[model samples]
Target: MSQTSNSSSRLSALLLAAMACAVSPAVVSAQSADSATAPGLPATPTPNATINLIRLMVERGLLPAADAAKLVEQAETEATQARAAITAAAQPAPVAPPPLEPDTVRVTYIPANVKRQMIEEIRSDVMAEAVAENWAAPRTFPEWVAKYKFFGDVRFRYEGDFYPDGGVPGGTIDFNRINTAAPVDYFSSTSTAQPPSYNADQTRERFRFRARLGSEIDLADNFTSGLRIATGESSSPVSQNQSFGASGGNFSKYALWLDRVFLKYEIQPKAGSSFSAIIGRTENPFFATSMIWSNDLGFDGLVLQGKRKVGENLTPFFTLGALPVFNTSLNFGTDSTASSGGGKAYASQDKWLYAAQTGVIWNINNDLTLKAAIALYEFQNVEGEVSAPIDATTLNTTSGFIGSTDSSRPGFAQKGNTYIALRELTNSTLPGAGNFQYFGLATPFRELAATARLDYNHFEPFQVSLIGEVVTNLAFNSGDIASNGPTQLPGPRNNNSFSGDYEGGNVGWNVNLQVGAVALQKAWDWTAGLGYRYVESDAVVDGFADSDFGGGGTNLQGYTVSGNLALSQNVWMGVRWMSANSIAGDTFKADVLQIDLNAKF
Candidate 1:
């Protein structure tokens, strides 16, 4: 290992030397001048403070002193001659003028055809080399091991709570005063006001591993297939405890799942337009994703997509498809033994989902970027019934809506009065030989959504971004929308009265300051930010309490402060604190501390 390491270091230095020589413009400029002064003399490098680097390296035994001195002497000689020639050429000169009664003007314009020919030649050479290197040609195998690329990240974390909550309260104050000011007593034992489930003990530890493998292969002149296998964890909307349900974490386990698998055949069936029909599972191509670069909102189905780039900065993208939607809530649940009758119940449906999204990217300026997209996504339940039985008097299924034909229906009616679902009786698994199923007429029930994202990064030392999204279900426009369908599955005692409509929106703002690293180049590179988010869910079910409305409450507003500190070029640590208050004065607070080390192999 040591021998290999030493050899690698030597190779790195060789490459650095080559790069330094290539861009040594100062030395080159002096050599060019010296060439004019003494035509037959060999050009030399210019003397500069940077050249001292070579001398220092030689002294430290990092470089050959003999070679370094020879190069330095040649450089100085060239610089001196160049300086002399330039000085001699600067001597005073006299100018004479002539007058003429008429003159004929002539001009020559070189055709860009010459430039095009030169570029084409260079391009052909590059292509030849790429083909020889097996870099440009598609792999021979469609599977097994085509051309694959892999990437991922790892993180380490450390957390310290000095005050155990708010860092000791900032001044001389009584313990009673501090307790009253923050109201931690009513919310939690820790001053942070976080749920006991999220504490992770005094100092928490968390690790994440994300990796993706992608490859593409050609089947014909215009047909190709591609696939991606990725493993990663994503945050969920539902509470962690409820979301994971014993998968072992509020955070789901990482598993190898297909992010995309599609086959495409180009259609030249035009002059200025073209199209491609893609079949299989792939990104829905709708919605704006910030945390995940690839399509976070992917669906399984067929898509007919088309693209046209009128100019360098303007392009239009369109896609339409009938996709399959997996119930994220149910998909992440842990019911491993439920099939054996020992875990939480599950609900699922059997129905085809669909979605469509069309958007355009308009580059108005170099520094400013803008995009607009409109999308429609529908979630359909496939299974018409839930077979999982919880116990006697209870049917364990995946969810309440999963076992029935009208799984997507919001609520039921009881005694001429509508009430939201009391519970899903089908989540429990029954003593059965087959999985439960549901069926329903395919409906184009759509969620109309729009988003606007502006990235203003050209302003220089600081980068700013503003993003916003708004979505609403057009079918359920009214405040008291109700589902006029069967209330429950076949059961001994049928008691169903559930009806409610929930509509909500969120707005948030963030500001950041990038601190300079020039002052403390190694120990302190950082960015500090402050953010605020306001969310409100209106017209909740009449029975559910406000505190249980959304993730936090019916109406939520939070203030957060965070920063990242760099301990090295490849490693950094981050911390964030958030304090949120419900409309009813309830508080939900969180603190996160994390460290990350990143390097490429």
Candidate 2:
């Protein structure tokens, strides 16, 4: 019984030891292989350590092999159950949901009344500020005044005229003897005579200025009115510059004259198409250069212009115009002569000009543009005529001479037209009458002109342009021009006759190349150009050609070099040089240099 008891205690002790080993950290770590795959089962135990312990126990005769195996199995089973219980305890518990309410949807928003109140508050503030700033003040003005715009420009210039010594051949003339029997001696005069010639080679300098003011107003729907006042002589069509020394020793105030006043009406029937009519001393209605017409010249008459777009990049245009170039009305009736006596006579006539043009503008690409035009211009009733007043004078040798009586001549002679002097018919009582001359327009003028321009603006802030123009006179009648006879006045054998064949057939051409910084606002902005022009005598109305070239007349060929540099946003300085020579009857040369400062507003 004592031995049995001892054996039982030993087995109990061994079982307790086995159970402690199974709960060891090593055993727990080994059993972590896969608790997920098997719910109450441990991973297969590692046999190395467990097997050694069991064998030692058996060998020491503490227990039989089968008993050791049974103890090991019991330990593993307990450990697996322990691990499963731990895993189960670590898992989350099932949660119970709260009680349900009735079905409904909820929305949160400001009330409409509150939103309206906020908007009204903002409006009231704005209105109060506007009232404080006088936004509700009543305004009174003429309806026409509200549609008007005013603009103008001013220019100051320093000019120089330089002539070489041994003056150009055929450059001298005696105005007093222009109508004498002599041949006028214009072609054979020498510059180095004992007394210098009238047009002796010399240098002259002067300061000049020009100013203009203009206004445009909308008169009615599609109708507009424009007017301009400028500083210059009323009869001068090509220049507005006034010389500083004309005051005769005092500070002289310059004269101002009407430059332009016109009315325009436009109609647009559809997109990309329009037509316009202008009347009353209007702007030049053609695409022309100074080669054909001066920039300052205005036309007095009516013009019709129209344009239409054919495609995205092409436009065609047309212009037709008529202008009254001159009007002369004069009466000669002396106090000593009866109302129906032979002394009463009259001279009256009118000159008219008509023009037509067709052109196209092509925008070749984003950077290039081209324009071309063809034009025809005609002059009518330009020839001088002999007329009789209501109470006419009988024909007499001394009475019928040009300038002999007030009825024989026009009141004013346009500056640049070729003229013939009537020396025998002069009146000593009249001042500046010793050299009276008559415009020799014995035939009409018919002209055809072609023009083209190209512009390239691909380079930023810089542009280049090439321009060309050609004009030809087609109504040349030498016979009719030469048929013009001397004055019928009886004098010392009127020796002066129309010396040469006065034909109207002539050609004029001009070409220019220019490069510049297109916008002249920034510092250092500049432009420059070189040009050549050749205009034959009678090719165009000399009074309307470039007034600064060759002393403002035709029969000239020249080269011009010009440049401008910006001084400020709306001001610039310009320099130009022109070297020109006459192309007809006499050899004449002139050089003009100009420096100008200009401002615009």
Candidate 3:
């Protein structure tokens, strides 16, 4: 209908133009006058262009105004029909196309430099945030939520011991050994000049305190670094203040030492395994609570540990690594001159100690587990200075004849005239006192250890556990011997007074009881246990005369009673008492009490 209207309008415009030109002035007037009588057609023409045709006709005396209007309307109607037909013919044909929606497009790219700049900006923003909060970057945080964390342990202690004296009474003077070939003033002490007696006045009062501070940083998803400052024999160089001398003086010196500083790599296992790699100083993986014969103590090495599940109930573990052993020295004199024998006067041997080990762990059941391990440790060789004989009648004054021994060689004989031999001694023919001497090698001394541990736990109302442990020195088993030098018995062994071999085995055992949730469960969760240890060592001292020196054995047996009380999940306290018996018939005892608190942020 709309199309028809548009067509009709066009036709009317054409017709109007044509008619205005075609009609004469007189004819238009006559036609308009006859319109009323002959309505179908205009009767005459008139010059009506100046006005609308109807009005012009009326004024020209052609017809009445009303009849002229009617004729004009009829002409307009016919013209409308004609225009409709012509317009319809002139319209363009519509074209068909597949249906679709127009799509809008956008493009974007980030150049390398711009991307880097944006990253730097983000980092700066993050750094600012960290500083405002007194926090660290993501790499420094121990956990996802913590950018950085501070952790430390402080142990305040009041300790006491039975033997207030500096050392166990009646114990043999073994300082004849010195790590250095020459004397070191820094390592020597006054104790070596004169042998101290077991006088009550020399005993010491015991008091002690220890602390540790540490932090961890996460460098990446699998990498982390941790450092700790600790005070204690196990962690640091500070010896515990077990007692005070009778003179009312501290017997042990306290100092700070770095316990641990290392980077750890945690490898995410594929499905059911665990792996860890550590670089720098770390603890040796061994079963014995005490590192009786392993060199994996302190810094300077790398370690690898891995755990894999072989079966449903069996998980095997292994550790491999090398560590450097630090030698300890004691001085006997206040002067630069090294002492012939006794405590206090030597320096640690300058050499690198090497070690390596591998081990496996198996779970027999929920209540039983077992571990087997083997290790190789290399210790630096220790050499001592030799002294000449003092006189023939007074015995060797320089050798400080603490005991006496006999040798086949004339020089091995004592200088004393008619000297009475109090004790019989066993002498080894092996050279260098069977010290496994490899003097030519850059690093000569080493000791290997093999250990096995079996543990059992019974879960009833209370948790009860039993652990049995054993260790053996592989160096002894090898039967390697240094050259048995000149049989000079009365004099120091081959210019080395401290020549000797370390041979021994250790056994340790422990029984643990975890107090069940009994009447005290509401207030205290506790565990009480007892542990026992035994060490047997055979020490051989060569070059002493039968009248002055001898080699003997030392055995130590000790027991520890410990109790643990958990005030709460985050708070706990522990107490322990340890007592030991030396082969020399000396008894020593120590007691420790500790309190600890832990919290989560």
Which candidate leads the pack in TM-score?
2
TM-score of decoy 1: 0.43
Each prediction's Cα lDDT score?
0.42, 0.65, 0.42
- Residue 497 lDDT in model 2? 28
How far in Å is the alpha carbon of 499 misplaced in model 3?
Answer: 20
Model 1 C-alpha lDDT per residue in residues 301-404, reported as the tens digit of each score? 78887767667787677778776543334542243333333454434544555667788877879877777787765545421222333231232223332222
TM-score of 3: 0.49
Off-target runs (Cα >4 Å) in candidate 1 are: 1-205, 218-222, 232-259, 265-276, 290-297, 311-313, 326-349, 381-445, 460-463, 477-595, 598-601
Once fitted onto the true fold, the runs of candidate 2 whose alpha carbons sit more than 4 angstroms away are: 1-145, 166-200, 330-347, 385-437, 487-505, 519-521
- Writing each residue's lDDT as its tens digit, candidate 3 over 195-306 gives 2222222333345555667778778779888887665443312132122232234565654567778888988576557899888865444444342422223446677778
Candidate 3 at residue 177, lDDT? Answer: 27
Model 2, residue 386: displacement in angstroms? 6.9
